[model samples]
Target: MKIPPHRYPSPLGRCQPEIMDVETTKRDGWQEQHILVVSGDDSRLDFVEREFIRRLGNRLYGGKRHE
Candidate 1:
């Protein structure tokens, strides 16, 4: 899944610090699946989220870059 970067406001209507939550779940006798939740300032989260997506994509697709 691809997540577009977006800002999340606090209860007071102010932008809050960002948090990226990554969860991996495995069902019985099944392969594990991943879920990623991204919340925060769009600018800040964009870079981080893009990096994560790039790395994951590379790994999954057997790209040359790995770091």
Candidate 2:
């Protein structure tokens, strides 16, 4: 017998549909790396930026800035 999946209510609540519309632009060529386009409230954008910097650090800029 197969078991049914259980769903838990999220403490954060549901996401805003209007605020969740995201668009992305694609680029060609090896030098033109793929980009993530985030469109939303400032807080959301800020959060993504902070996370990228935290995880990528100087590598975000190809690591040449630190050198």
**Per-residue alpha-carbon lDDT of candidate 2 for residues 1-67, written as tens digits (9 for 90 to 100):** 9998998988667663445323322223223775543323336457777667655744654544443
lDDT of each: 0.54, 0.51
Off by over 4 Å in 2: 1-34, 38-42, 45-49, 62-67
Once all C-alphas are superposed, what RMSD does model 2 give against the true structure? Answer: 14.6
TM-score, structure 1 vs. true: 0.28
Candidate 1 lDDT, 1-67, residue by residue in tens: 9898897856875566556433332232134334443333335457778777667766766676557
What would the TM-scores of all predictions be? 0.28, 0.19
Angstrom error of the Cα, residue 12, model 1: value is: 58
Best by TM-score: 1
Model 2 vs. true fold: TM: 0.19
